[model samples]
Target: MEANELLRKVRKIDIKTRGLSQNIFAGEYHTAFKGRGMTFSEVREYQYGDDVRDIDWNVTARHNHPYVKVYEEERELTVMLLVDVSRSRLFGAVGEEKREMIAEIAATLAYSAITNNDKIGVIFFSDKIEKFIPPKKGKKHILLIIRELLDFTPENQGTDISVALRYFTDALKKRCTTFLISDFIDTHDFTRQLQIACNRHDVIAIQVYDKRDTSLPDVGLMRMTDLETGASRWINTSSKRTRQAYSKWWYERQQSMSDTFSKCRVDHASIATDEDFAHSLMALFKNRGVR
Candidate 1:
């Protein structure tokens, strides 16, 4: 994309995502992800309903009055966005591309993190780590991330989610909330890596897909390309047997992925290219908040 066009696109995404973070996700985001712990703030006069254990006896003795130590939640966290930028993200049939939806979701999450006074970072990965924007605070940092998300391209075309999960687990020693955004179309088994990552840090999966990915339209023979592998083939979409087999394969794949996530104890949500993502996101947040 041209420089001017890229800037306009980034600004457009920023406006929409920022508004969502501020209006819809502010409270739920706060509730879903909590701070590290409470830190001592100051000592104040003891109240009748105050916890007796919190009483500052030393201060009370010195001041000749009852006082209590006050503490506030340490509301500083580092959030990471593990984004998949493989060539497959460019494939979409129902108006919106998976890449576009991924970018928008990432931007929304970044904005939500910043709103909570937290540092936000991103790891863009294809078969390898394409880029890593270190965790930082401020609107400027977020805008820079948005620009990169809009314009950045990957060197590889294949998908290997294990590589990204391994990198994320090794790089960030401190515990953080991570969002793994992808279509979950991997040939490799990432169950072990995902389990390890989730054991160490809080990881949530946001799967973005398209309607065409699950089934084929009954329009006779159609040519299709594997975006990640660059392989091409023609299939008879009008054949009931062919369509049924394809749908069965897709369903089994989804079930297996769901099983992996369940075994890892990870929260996840799936969004389609033509669906309203806001409701799904809100539902995810509400579920987490309740827990």
Candidate 2:
């Protein structure tokens, strides 16, 4: 894309996603991901109803009066967005492309992290690491991330989720809340890596898809191509049996993906280009709250 066109696209995404982060996702984002732990804030005079266990003996002795220790949740945290920028993300039959949706979702998450006074970072990857924006706080940092997400093209066309997850685990030593955003069409056993990552950091999976990806309508003969492999084939979409079998296979793929995520105890949610992503996100947040 040209420089001006790229800027325009980035600005457009920023406007839409920033509004969502500010108005809709801010509260739920904060509630869904908790802070590291409580930290001592201050000490105050013990009230009659104050818990005796909370009294600070040293402070009490110094002041010759009982003082209760006060602590607050350490709200500062690091949030990482591991985004897949593979060729398949460019395929979309309705609404925006999968890559576009991923950009918006990532921007919203970044803004939400900044809103909560947390540091936000991102790793854009395909078969290999494409770019890494170190965790930082501020609107500038978030906008920089948004711009990169909108414009950063991947060097590879294939997806290797295990490589990305392994890189993330090695780079970020501290515990963080990591959002893995992708279509998850690649092959590799990430269950072990994901389980380990979850043990060290909170992991959430946001899987993006298109309705057409799950089924084909009776639109007669159609040409289909694999974006990642560049393989082309003609399919008789008009045949009912063909469409039914294709739909069944698609459903099985989705079920297998869901089952894999479940086995790893990872919180996963799906968003289709044809559906309202806001509703899906809200539902996921509400579900997380229940947990």
> Which has the greatest TM-score?
1
Which portions of model 1 show Cα errors greater than 4 Å? Answer: none
Q: Compute the lDDT of residue 186 as modeled in candidate 2.
A: 82
Give the TM-score of each candidate.
Answer: 0.98, 0.96
Q: Model 1, residue 119: displacement in angstroms?
A: 0.3
Clashes of each: 0, 0
On residues 20-92, what C-alpha lDDT tens digit does candidate 2 reach at each position? 8889988898888899999999999999988899999999999999999999999899999999999999998
Which pairs, if any, clash in model 1? none
Off by over 4 Å in 2: none
Tens-place lDDT per residue, model 1, 37-110, is: 99999999999999999999999999999999999999899999999999999988895999989999999999
lDDT of 2: 0.89
